[model samples]
Target: LHSYTKYNTWDTILSWINSIASSNPSLVSKQVIGNTFEGRPMTLLKLGKSSGTTKPSIFLDCGIHAREWISPAFCQWFVKEALETYGSDSQMTSLLDQMDVYVLPVINIDGYEYSHTTNRMWRKTRSKLSGSSCLGADPNRNFDAGWCTVGASSNPCSETFCGSTPESEIEVKHVADFIRKNKSSIKAYLTIHSYSQLLLFPYSYSYNLAADHSELMSVAQGASAALTSLYGTRYTSGPGASTIYLAAGGSDDWAYDLGVKYSYTFELRDTGYHGFLLPESQIKPTCEETMLAVKYIAAHVVFSQ
Candidate 1:
């Protein structure tokens, strides 16, 4: 049986990715985009059946904040669902037939491990910058979108520390660079986080409207509706700054600013009942509903493109 029933550590997650790719040779392949600050290989598992041609793609990642363990678990669950349901489910089959999904299972590998081992709430990269005793920059706040401005903090010790520079975090840099390189074919970007139950789109850095503001709002609405259809779980979807608090430098904003028109950040599950320590028992339901929303977005990207 698939082992996503429980929360997994870094090694277990990596091993699962490897196992999935190896077992699904016809449909899945692996890419090592870069190494983390702690020398862990950051892996991207690309899922699609080969058709002897390049296809439009979607970029998805989770655990950029490290402590949001459920975020990364959703990535794993997504891959598992894609692999297992591809041949049987018409929607997944068609989505995979038309596009490739690039998944980075865990962006903040070092801090994710640290969260499990040392601090259960560590939410930054395990990097040591000059002139600071504090270890780790909030990788989510280290992106180049709005940078350190607004809800992000300049203090290194703050939980929301924006790194010294945009792209300062190696993991963020690698992910950003890869998306930039693949910008032409990347149709959508989805970054998963937790405890807010919101599906947010671009212009997160500012209250100003994105070019496709109305369309993104419409898609998010449909996607949110789809999520609610399963388990009746309610999720509010809108532009990040207005729906959620203004947290600049989020990956969703960075990806949106980079021209991925369908960019979104999924704040998965709970209104803070479990907080960062969401129980493992909730993983399956969370992933189930999240899969619905993801497919809803992926469908929009596929058919609407």
Candidate 2:
């Protein structure tokens, strides 16, 4: 029952994770993939049954946009729920028996902390660029897929600023490297964001449909329907560019490019009344509903194979 509104600080989040890992070493494994430009450690937690060699893996990431506190909270909640219900709940136990869940609670630690300490709306990594005073690069737009093309900004100060080069930000590089290393086992890649209520799939760089468009749309619709069943939260599902605003170089698209079959970007919770300021009370229900969607997708991934 972690509160996102109060625990938005990076230090507190990291400390909480440390405490969990310390107490439950057998269930939680922490891995530091890399360091942010501001020297904050970019950590990931791996959760699953202990005695499996080749379980299918799903990658879940949150807070890539910095101000999306609810996004990261959901990631943390997913980890806890998975660990708590592993052998007791039939669905969770079955999922864990077949798949390993990798959760990156906060992808943009520097920007997330900056949002807590200085600004309430920061959306990028706090990386200083030469010849400009504006800090940070949009980690979402820093991926290598269709780099600097449509739905991205070149100017350093823009909210959608693509970095000077693809994978320029250490955060983006680290995630890319981790995905690459686990490419064989990963079946789904989910990046959680806030304020839009969208379940978006690939080919975000253009209007052209993905080769697996029909199958992707089917899973997206199923996941969306599952969420709606829980809280009547309706989500528009389609290609990222068509469903929402198009943004080039997004992790979802990049993961698709890297051969992860089911890549999605989930824009969670309320649709802009609260916007980035999603309340703590909604965290539990949000995570619970989103978990239904996640399980729907995971079950599909398993059954299809």
Candidate 3:
């Protein structure tokens, strides 16, 4: 129950979610928090046991950047697998029984659609700014963690533009609001990205180490090891600034600021040989392998709690 090739379109992704909700009425519920810049619905899928509010919760999202198709694909695949195996698989069933998973696939719907139609390498939203010709803002850089201070640009045309203000992008604002509403229950926050084999934790805004740096590194190491066990793929685990380039105002840092104990940014699939132009053929294996890491992290979070 994995989809790697299709669902790149907003309609297709929404249709898939709707179909799942229809098929599994008791297990699946969709929440429309708001709309994207292009009027695309910002949807969140709530999965796991239907029991009341005592269970822990996890937040997972992908497609903050439009050109990163692999990000959203893995998210859809994760949701599909979670629902399909919840009853039969002991691990999944146990986790679901004690925890709720909230997944937002295709966060930047307008930019994602725009990438398919006009630009193959588009990386921002499509919001129009007054007195500026730039089309969009980098949703990843629109978060409130050291926003636009470093590793981010002030110019609207830059790829890493932090937007006029924190949470300026509608997509980011919606996600921030959702996370804020569930802050107390959310134990871990994960946002999927692409073009690098990395499992990065905060503080992306600076080279300084996090207060729980040891725990963060430990979880990232475990997740990376799990991913490697599945397909022999190697993933470097560390802080975002050390492992990759420093990028202020990223979702992972913002999640950490919100007191989520475990916050991670996963950069999936092949390295920069293809960059954002990852082939459709690599989708299935990528999603499959990443699932091992995700499940490992989820289990660790549950046990630690």
Candidate 4:
């Protein structure tokens, strides 16, 4: 059995997804949003009590960058924590009772698998382009928001290659389509990434602030505070372009453009000493502290709705 505190291979994660949902029928269910370039099923785990209707939900996805193993680790940890603490942890209890959390545990399945087995630093999807020898596009830059305009590359071989076009990668299209279909009910969009220890909101394509800038900043500040409270691990909170580098076509920006106002991207864990190679020994603490920030955001979404 794969432990939630450690990184697991795609096969192990796939099995874990099936087993976890099957074991907790009432609290969780799996949805196959779409398949990847390698035809691996991209499964989504829905976490919430049986509400008999589609309630307001938060969409959280991880592993968009194949090299960020901690990203997927946090997703699995979030689900495990939510399930294990639902009734015991009042915040988690209330969040589940009132709102659903849709989690895509691993977005770049092929790339992630490749990273584990071939190269530890592989960071893009594994799709073969029609005319170029390049294998994949940066899934983060494959969205429709200000795509390939800034901080992204036009060359197919570049690490930050923004696909041939927005949603050119099947994985990106799959996620975009699902969010579009549930845009009305998804109150928040949170995409997990690693090594920066920062929380950012949209407008990455430009210096312009999101329409709900102040509110998003406030929520991110609160979540950052919540995260810091657990272990004094600091996280800078601000707009993406200004807080970090400007990255176009990110899912957070795209979802925000689609009207999911509370869109945020979390660059998790240590500043840079570890980078994408975050240790398994730190997984527990990282996930535990991250849980606080995530719960804070989820609680805000549940009550704000």
Candidate 5:
């Protein structure tokens, strides 16, 4: 039930997280960053070969949109591979030994549970709105970066509704606070989403290129190439607004503005044939190829710094 091939419910994922952390005490440990809207603990799994002193790390999160099940599956698969390949896989070994990887398997836990039981297409947090019948805001569009601008909606019933204010969703605030506190040691920020094979960088809120735009572009191209090498899954890489659409208030853009220079957003798998309902059969291959791209980006962060 908790295998990488299939999407697990919140309960199963919680159990899996507990088992993994308990079994691999040295390689992995759980930190409760904060609780979700429905009070489910937002557990962050910090993975590294423990050292007495602090080390630079990369922060990665998935399932910002509840219906994107494959996103969370990748996070779980990444942890499994990191633990299983240590000492044998040189790149992974060096990655874990050199720096830590903070993985939040599912950020929107309450909405995720609602998606599983109530609505298969639900795409926001499950928090209730003050004066409206609608519930939840798009967590991706709930960040403080150009919040509610351009691509986001102000209507509470809209799918892309930006909250009343930045970090209006408690889940978004918790993650934002964590990143703000660790900005110095965090080298890169990676947020996973689905239904589009794209790798994007900062300034999704506007058309302006980032200060490190050239380097970010080069790294993204390399990562995309690496991903294509495995299973021939191609990905287009560029700035979010220009490449895809004018999406504002995204985590990647916010993190980039916050000084995490190597920030990126990975839109995985098919371009939209399966959409959010990506099948379990594609999980292994999807994760395998995505791992190549992620490693490529992480390696750049490790060596280039």
Candidate 6:
């Protein structure tokens, strides 16, 4: 059992994924989707009851921004809980029986390492953009939804830099490519971020609403209610741009645009007392409530299908 009491390094997290997959051969497996600019492997954990045919899937990726340590912790905790409770927990059992989950535990491995070793607040990929002195671009802003417009910055040094072009960050590109390739099978896209308890959907790039706005809002409201019922962790659920900021090129919006109607962005935990430095003590409770919210969405996906 990997304790959620401490933040592990990139290598240690990878080890946990590989070890869990090996130990639970029938329930979980992993694949190296792509490599970061610093040569770190971007691994995805595939969780499901072994079945030959494809099932509807929900893709949950965490730690896209490096400083948000708790995001990756949730991913690890969710995986452990999913495997441990598959037989005992009714919701998890039914979810695994009817659907599959693919989790990218640490998407920005290079930047995560940098946050641990050098800067304690690094939030971008470590990729050195050509002809620029700045070392990285915000992976969130590197998606194709709105490219380098609106809330995104054009300067490479800015924290919200959208990069030279869409899909400029290799990490973002890897996720986009994988989702694009698996778009048909994937019914939901859940990307986890932090420092604000929000359950957001598409149209972060524009004020316009998603085509499936009504259904998405209904499900998100139900999931948010489920999450709050656990620990009273209140989450405002709505469109990303309106609920949060107008940050464009988000993976949530991109995935929604790619035809994954259930795309969501979960800004988890505190509204900013701890910010990116969320303590290890809060990990278990956070993960517990978050699991409820995630399962709620999963149930909705399964039932609706």
**Model 2 misplaced regions, further than 4 Å:** 1-6
**Global lDDT for candidate 2?**
0.88
The positional error of residue 81 in candidate 4, measured at the CA in angstroms, is 0.6
Backbone clash pairs for candidate 6 read none
Summarize candidate 2's per-residue lDDT along 1-305 as a digit string, tens digits.
Answer: 33543445788788877777777777777899999899989889887766647678899999999899888888888887887888888888888777778889999999999899999999999999998899988898999999989989999989899999999999999999999999999999999999889999998988888888999999999999999999798888999888787679999999998899899999998999999898788888898999999989988987876
Let me know the TM-score candidate 6 reaches against the reference structure. Answer: 0.98
lDDT of each: 0.91, 0.88, 0.89, 0.94, 0.94, 0.90
For candidate 6, write residues 1-305 as lDDT tens digits: 45666788887898888899999999998999999988988989999997789988999999999999999999999999999999999999999988999999999999999999999999998988778999898988889987777899999889998988999888888889999999899999998999799999998988898899999999999999999998899999999888877988889898988899899899888889998888899988899999988999999899989
Cα lDDT of model 5 by residue, 25-115, tens digit:
9999999999998899999999999998888999999999999999999999999999999999999999999999999999999989999
Cα lDDT tens digits for candidate 3, 246-290: 889999999998999799999997888887888888888899899
Task: Supply candidate 4's per-residue lDDT for 201.
Answer: 94
Give model 6's clash tally. 0
Which regions in candidate 3 have their CA more than 4 angstroms from the true location?
A: 1-4
Provide C-alpha RMSD values for all models, in order. 1.1, 1.5, 1.5, 0.7, 0.7, 1.1
Q: Least lDDT summed over 10 consecutive residues: which range in candidate 4? A: 296-305
Q: Estimate each model's TM-score.
A: 0.98, 0.96, 0.97, 0.99, 0.99, 0.98
Which 10 consecutive residues of model 1 have the lowest summed lDDT? 1-10
Clashes of each: 0, 0, 0, 0, 0, 0
Worst 10 residues of 5 by lDDT: 1-10
Q: How accurate is candidate 5 locally (lDDT)?
A: 0.94
lDDT of 4 by residue, 1-305 (tens): 69987899999999999999999999999999999999999999999998888889999999999999999999999999999998999999999999889999999999999999999999999999989998899999999999899999989999999989899999999999999999889999999999899999988999998889998999999999999998999999999999998989899999999999999999998899999999999999999999999989888888887
Error of 4 at 111 (Å): 0.4
